[model samples]
Target: MKDQQDIVDNPPPGGSTGDPFTISNSLNAAQTVTVWIAKGTRWSDRDQVKAIKVVYADGTARVHGNQTGTSHSFKFDSDERVTSMGIWTGDRVDRIKWETNQNRTFDHGGWGGTEHSEELGNGILLGFSGSADSHELISLGASFREDSD
Candidate 1:
């Protein structure tokens, strides 16, 4: 078992910051990890929490937020918005989805290039695994596995 400090300098391969929940180690097939967290900070204000999540790095992922309540006997919470989101990695997006938030169709958005497109995935939908602003350079298809079936 690894600790939060371990994954800091030497993060696992293909890791990312989209991970709202921190992972302590690599997950094996059919394996589940329960983040005990022991004690930590949720915000800069140092708000504490029983925040927990199930990290499964096999086929898909499940991200949920804990509302933290009582009389519920306390249990693992689930968030569908970001649940089982597909990961896209490549030169071009496997799919160019909502660059913004609206609700329309593919290759189409509002009047000002604003995307109200389909919610194919989560986050920006096209946040690009990379950290830049080079959408025009991205072509129709990325040879990366994230695009190819």
Candidate 2:
């Protein structure tokens, strides 16, 4: 487990634009995560991430960015917890991948851009913070807390 002092907010990746948003789950764990991926009108353009929604164990939910693409949802098992995440970004978020403690993996979006991976070694995902526009997600970052056990 990581030290409590080591848990801190990660800065958003990519060329972030638009208003900043923060969605936190400090007291509970996440139950589900949904991501939206959008493709450009032109055939040569690559796909980009549009939005993300997370539902917590308490039944409360929060979402950011725009709903302008295909949506993919991943539900966690009772004992499953997200252990790490990877994001690819350019001018916008291009791809996202999440891995659970159970070794389950969930992925979304297209492959094009710089990749940023977060390995949360026993740390709890506390929430997300980032910037987004009406058309797509501009940037994303994860927040974590030290595992108490």
Candidate 3:
């Protein structure tokens, strides 16, 4: 399932209708520094997983994980620079953090600093990344969170 993201203080992105799910919407609509869940379909119905493809109007997506459950949070950010962020949770390992490609490319973990994440429920994780460049602010990694319900 997909819909326009307009919640809380977070408004629509690009001011271009904000209807980003349309195939006609330019892929460029997804270049920003925010994170919003794209909405998932019911599992038994054979729902195709919909992932966040563009940047957000608020801050970005953050994921949290633990034995208790996995959790995800999306909000607005004013001053955070990141290049890549991700959350990895599994039976053996569970971890999350954000980093700057420039920092990692140069062996500087401090470059992008660490992205903060928290677990919401099960193995479902949430996350997001930012960059100095406004257009390239969000860089996230995850094949896609597994259904933790």
Candidate 4:
């Protein structure tokens, strides 16, 4: 019999556009996440999240969104896993922060929107899903596997 997985999804906030995308790792946990932030003169059209890439424990990886900014990487220890995430968004994603079980944290991007955070107690981050345009990431969300215990 196939293993049953309990997946929890957090939908993106309103005012998001462009092609829909989902990047996931059904079998392996996430090991690293890289985010690209574009620093532009204008806050409305630029200075936002450009793209994201997640590398799984299995050495497999996936990248989404646009590629037009400086890249920042968040690497996790072998025994560590993501516990929660915080996002700031408006018409586009403005900032992102990730906290791990080890209490390590990584924050990036400009602060220019409403803040949304989620604490996934004991849950393992599997992937991310949302919408993005050719210029930046319009919206962002997350998917995780709930702890069975």
- Report how far residue 30 has shifted in candidate 1, in Å: 30
Candidate 2 on 33-73: residue-level lDDT in tens? 78888884322388888888889888889999887778999
The C-alpha TM-scores of every prediction are: 0.17, 0.85, 0.21, 0.86
Point out where model 3 deviates above 4 Å.
1-55, 58-70, 83-86, 89-93, 99-149
Which candidate's lDDT is highest? 2
lDDT of candidate 3 over 9-119, digit per residue (tens): 111111121112211121112222222222112222211112232333343322221112222333223332335444332111123344432343111111122333432
lDDT of 1: 0.22
lDDT of 4 by residue, 104-124 (tens): 888888878888885463557
Residue 120 of model 1, lDDT score: 30
Model 1 residue runs over 4 Å out of place are: 1-80, 96-129, 137-149
Candidate with best TM-score: 4
Reference-based lDDT, residue 132, model 2: 86
lDDT of each: 0.22, 0.77, 0.24, 0.76
Least accurate stretch of 10 residues (summed lDDT) in model 2?
1-10
- Cα RMSD (angstroms) for every candidate in the order listed: 15.4, 3.2, 17.3, 2.4
lDDT of 4: 0.76
